[model samples]
Target: MIDATRPSAPPRRILVVDDDAGMRDSLEDLLSAAGWTVTTFGRAATALAKLPEVNPDVVLADVRMPGMSGLELLRELAKPEMPPVVLISAHGDIPMAVTAVQEGAYSFVEKPYEPHRLLSIVQHAADQFRMAADTKRLRARLASLSGLDRVLLGQTEEIRTLRQDVLDLAESEAPVLLVGETGTGKELVARALHDLGARPGGPFVAINCATLEQDRFEMEMFGAKDGPRGFLGEADRGSLFLDEICSCPERVQAKLLRAIETGTFNPVGADSGASSDFRLISASNLEPEKAVREGLLRADVFYRINTFVLRLPPLRQRLEDLPLLYSHFLDEFAAVYEIEPPQTSHEDMAALLAHDWPGNVRELRHVAERHVLAARRGRGSAAEAMSNDQQRSEFPGTLREAVAAFEREMVGRAIRAHSGRMDAAAEALGIGRRTLNEKIVKLGLDKDNWL
Candidate 1:
């Protein structure tokens, strides 16, 4: 049972290229004994042809070869991105081998080299190759996130700042505390911090403190001798995110403080403590300051974990970003349900904007999903279709009526404030002149009063 999310080490491979048939065989046998897949080529040219296919971790080539000398082969293969090559040379060719190394070969060995010494050199190259590949892979993965990841989704000032804050926080080893209301996607932000950080390949272990009972919280967090490895142990060398940290029991809080301070924790029923090295990321749905004032959270633990803090803005506070979020979720739901995305009229948009989204972005996404489902089922106009169960408790009884009322009031005010100047009114309302005029005509507002 392999953990697919865990990064596996790159396979070890050695390419032996020596025109001497006996020497090639000996090198192959030695590397194979060292538990590496070895491939032999009689000529440097033949090895070059197989380089891409085999992609060996290290290349061992003879200094004097038939088609291409080892130095010439090094010239062709010593790319910054390619696997390291170690040249084998006779004592007399020491100077040429040294030149090969200067050109980017990892190292060179004399003809009468010790087997152990040669193995040690190749092992070093293998380790270096693995590290380089891992770094490249991690960089590629992080770059992919900047394009399609959801953490940086909105166009609001708050979102832009949050993205930059995340990047800055990721550059350190300090603990992170995320504070926001429920459904504000705190976990997503935590993951972004982990994925973009130095240990992207490490595990991202998460647990909801609110879900853990007082008696089980310690065991779940710190692990036990006879039981499974707890979250802390599992997240070693990675990150551990505890959601609703305010809900952590008093007893567990003390232990957590010790773990972070000492980098070790006593597993349940174990006499000796175990090492626990991981980044700590915590989230609290409640106002952390309020919680501390109320004595629900320990002041000491809060200080330790709150080294870096980020607050995710509630969706209602960033209403201008509603359209982007709506479209994002609309496409997601459409693809998930295999249906066309439902069109949202200006009135429908106004209704959504008018409602107070207590569930934040999570609530908005559900509404988008339901709207698409209802439209696919041949329901009423998008407004009426979403008027029933999907309507927020804070919204008016009928979505269409509420939308009409909101539009008339807001548009009329914008028009009156601008003295019926369509261009000024449109700009004031954050809309285009054509849009404002259409709303004015549809709502049957009298322009004479402001004009």
Candidate 2:
């Protein structure tokens, strides 16, 4: 068995074949320096005879040999139980090396190679092999948990379509862009994509572009010289979700574009680039086109991400799903608070549905959690009474009456603060002077008798 902990196993029992004794010693020495257990053979047959006993991780054989050419030796070790074989050849034997790799050889190295180059390739291959094993184990674990129980609550046609779109995109390798109001569960959509994707075994790395400083955003997304893996690298062989992508600076967007195009990037001060394989998913509350027009987002970057788009309908547009979402949040909070779920009165539901949820689902969830916790402590009825009283105090009996009352209060305050200067009041209230004049006239605020 290979000593897995070894910095490098001499390919476990590398079989290096060469007619020249000096060349064999050179190869063995080089591999040994890299922590590989080197076994040199003067002839290919000798190496073949010891293959079963050696159980090598890799076999390095010269393409041109005296008896039993490297091709022939490769054929013998090509069995399913055999380890990967790397063929070494001279400059003029390029064709043979190409053929070797094409025929299932792990890789080929030319003579007089740089030691670092060879080691890098070998390390990459080893890492890939290890990742393959890890992916298999992860798939089994994920398969057990793959079910609809994890699906977020919503059954409206719009939500059903969004869920279906998420499911479809998860199975593909295309980039996804989610556009919605804040708190509409963009991250949830990204996660659903990951769960449905092929590389579910890998990590789900997320970065909020809006949260990072403009100067530090690039390093945060791509990584700094000595910091933790950047969002891109962290999600290697996994999924990366960039939230509020429109907020990323132009420089950061350029770097992200390169990474997406080439599947490679470097740390802030790194001298060399590192390759990564990650699926990209981005979300933004602002419209990308409008952002580009406003010079907040780059147009080129927008095109790259305009691929598969998923738009989450705001709470107002999906009012039909409110009852289901409300129940889900209530149940969740009930579980957390260790209390019986509070029932929503018909009037309560009507009020909730009527209000424009400026904060979207997040606001609803917060309200539900508060209610559940309050109910657990027997303050639920008091909280409801207070809320009702507050609403009654602020709101009129009818919509038209409510609008008139709100308008009168706002106009009265503006007029008083500006000392009745309509122009100044208009400017202060962010309305055109003409609009303010009309409002004053329509509300009869200009009546001298009232003044």
Candidate 3:
């Protein structure tokens, strides 16, 4: 019996328990030949002792064992999360078998059961168990998506859709490319993918491609011949997250493409290829096609890594979640500082939602921290701490006017701080340089004045 919905998880394993050694051997041989890894114990007590270690998909046991009856084992393993228990009953034990099945036993097989029938039942039970486990795990992940350490918190349509996408891709192994504005939490999504996937137990190797020097990147990614292993080696059997992938030079991109295509790399000075099986998750804040056209990214590399491109929407696109997201950060900081979260006013909410958050969620996080700090330090209204000027009567003109003024000041300040270098300014403002350029044109800011 095949289950279409069963998760591709651990292999099937069966535990057999009976005082009869011959019966145990027969059951092991039968189950093993049927493609189930089988472990057999002579006693129900011994099987119980090895239960945690075996962690079988199904337990096949004799109902009338001497030390601990299979009925007792059924009671012991009756948790809703535990695997199904199948009891082997004798001809005279039909009534007891019925009672056992009523008391949470999966089903009972008579002593003279047909091998095919038994295998069928076992397969059905294992598939159901796997289905239950996957459902429980998915529900748990969704519930804890926004834990204190994780920041993917929002209820807006945009955020909700993004969160669902993350969950859908979490269990998959195909390469994924993240395209989102900086500060939209691409790294966070990568972390979530690593944590929720099949390789959670393995290392998560993360590096910002933008920060890697060309020659240095090859050495770090492919490793040294004998002395050191690179990020590719470290990520074996796990995940590798590359942020700002558009910044990777053509030379590095070629080597990266080869490594990803073949799952093997020749370390510096190595004689032969070494393999590292890692799930590749790359992120680029700039529009991917634009980056390729601009010669910032390799077209071949882009195509290879973009098996699934997930786009995370910027905060302004999901403004309906502003209050929830801001409150989350306020609560987060308050707990860290061991102070009560300050009460934000209607004016504070207005200030927050009035403007487009150019820097996205990362900007909101910073603002929220500042807002909390202001109250902690006895400063006035939290919203005014960043965007409000007393002489401006909250804002200078229309909603667009108010938002534009705040955005221009913020973007210009970031550019000025970086001496008008767009790359540095973009990094400082938690946005791509292309996005910053668009912002500059839209806001009508003179970069020379800022410099």
lDDT rank, highest first? 3, 1, 2
Local accuracy of candidate 2 as per-residue lDDT tens digits, 137-172: 665465335532233457888877876676667788
Quote each prediction's TM-score.
0.55, 0.53, 0.59
207-234, model 3: which lDDT tens digit per residue? 9875666558788878988857988999
Which of 1 and 2 is ahead in lDDT? 1
Against the reference, the lDDT scores of all candidates come to: 0.81, 0.74, 0.82
Ranking the candidates on TM-score from highest down gives: 3, 1, 2
lDDT of 3 at 64: 86
Off by over 4 Å in 3: 1-130, 141-150, 387-451
lDDT of 1 by residue, 69-150 (tens): 8888888986778889898877437577668868998998998779999999999998998898887786557746843245
Best by TM-score: 3
Q: What's model 2's lDDT at 425? A: 79
Q: What is residue 354's positional error in candidate 1, in angstroms?
A: 0.6
Top-lDDT candidate index? 3
Clash pairs for candidate 2? 10-36, 10-37
Error of 3 at 61 (Å): 30
Which residues of candidate 1, in runs, are more than 4 Å off? 1-148, 380-451
Q: What clash count does candidate 2 reach?
A: 2
